[model samples]
Structure formats: structure tokens, C-alpha cells
Target: MTRPKISQMEAYMIETLRASGVTNEAIIQAAKEKDVSTWKQINDQYDFEQLLVLAEQDFSTFEEIINDGYAVKFVTVGGLERLLKLKFQKVEGKDFQKLKTGVQGLDLSGSSLDELKQMLSINWKITKNNEYVSVLLKEKKDFA
Candidate 1:
């Protein structure tokens, strides 16, 4: 017997539902009925929206600490990978490789702070006070 094919989105949704403890029987029933409302109803029980808010808050706090002359170093790939896993829960090795490749392409070896800031294409202010260098991201108006 030939198996029914499902779209990538459908597969992803089914996997998510399964991971969230929805049974295979329930998934099959939803598929047969052509109704994803059951999956949506279960999904609505989770606080994913609040999770996003909390993640943003945490990132802002980290950025603030970096801006305050506290160095946040990722000394090893393993350490960075672990942090990514903690923040995202699931990050594939290929994704990390792509990220590393993109970062490596930046090539900031010979660039000065101003050049690096320009290359980043964001409103970043670099403040060097005697011993410490602080990089802060701000709005264009703040820079002006």
C-alpha cells in the first residue's frame, strides 16, 4: 500500500503536536478530518508567546551588560553551542556551521572599531574609556 504524502509544514506541525504529547491516534484523527484545530487548541495551552517575551528580555539584559563594559566572551565553540542549545532548545550542527561560516566571512582582523561598526550595518556606538571598550546598539536618533 502506498503511504499518503504530507507537506513539510504538515509534517512539522504533526511532529510538534506529537512532541507536546498528542497521541498518534489523535493526530491520525485530525488528519482524516482535515482539521488542525485540535492541534491549535492544544498549542494554545502553551505560553510560547510569553516565552518569546522572556527570551527578548534576557537578550536585552545581556546586551546591556555588554554595553556596560562587562565582557561576555564565547571562548570555545562548545561553550557557544551549549548557550545556543539552552536558548533555542534545538540547534542542528549544520545550522551552527552556517552561522560560523557567516561570522567568519565578516573578517574583522584589520578593521578599526569604526569600520567594524559600519560593516555591521546597525546603529552601534563604541565607547572606549581608558581600559574598556563597550559596544552599544541604539536607535538612529540616539546616534544623531
Candidate 2:
């Protein structure tokens, strides 16, 4: 079985951050926020929803979060993925790559309710908007 291990580069960065010389705020924040374990499990291994879990929780209806600010209820499977993909699909450059419907072995057909949520995140590129906005599905493969 393949296991996740912290890369030498990430360790080097962490050590560099620990050193007294580096004093940049963003770099310091990056050092504090970076996780080696997350980096490992994320490479074509863990589900895409793992990234979404780290994102800010949003409520369609204010009532859901008003109760405890923890409970999330996805109304429909397609609704959620459509929301995510529509919100995150990348559209830029002179020529933008069109996304195929296959990712992490997730097709629109067999993916479960929870699995669909893994695709949601704040890391999306706004491409265009005539009637609706287009978003690129930033995948696990994009991570360093």
C-alpha cells in the first residue's frame, strides 16, 4: 500500500521557516499553515472533498448555520457539484483548456452526496459570464 510522507522540499521549507532569518508575514503564514500529511494524502489518493472540508462553510439559507454554525445540508447531488464546478471552472489565457467530466474516478453518475462536496473550494478562476459564470474544477492533481 502506498503511504503519504513529507517530501524533502517541504521539510526544507519548514526548517527554513523555523530559522531566524526569514521574517516575511506571508512566508511565515505559509509555513504555519502548510501540512506535510495533507500534501502526501492529496496526491491522487484522498478524495477531492478533503480539500473542500478545509474551505469556508457557506449556507444557501441563513437558517442552517444560524442554529449551530456547523450543520451542512446539501439539498441535491447535482445541485452541489453544479454549484462547485460552475463556480470554479478555470477560464483564462488566450486558450483555456476544457475540462473533461472524469476526475478521481468521479463521474456525474456514481458519485455520492458527500463525495460531490469534495469538489467545492474558494480556489477557482472566474472565466466568463454572459448569463452564468464559468468556473474550473481545480483538482488534486494541481497541487504541488
Summed over model 1, clashes come to 0
TM per prediction: 0.28, 0.19
Candidate 2 residue pairs in clash (backbone atoms < 3 Å): 49-118, 88-135, 88-136, 89-135, 89-136, 90-136
Error of 1 at 39 (Å): 1.7
Candidate 1 runs further than 4 Å off:
1-4, 33-35, 42-90, 93-96, 99-144
The 10-residue segment with the lowest total lDDT in model 2: 62-71
lDDT of 1 by residue, 1-144 (tens): 112222222323434555677765554444444455545565664433332232245544323322221222112334333422332233544332323312111212223433333322234344555543344444468856
> For all candidates, what are the clash counts?
0, 6
Give lDDT for model 2.
Answer: 0.31
In angstroms, the error of model 1 at 104 is 16
Residue 85's lDDT within candidate 2 is 42
The reply for model 2, stretches above 4 Å from the true place, is 1-120, 139-144
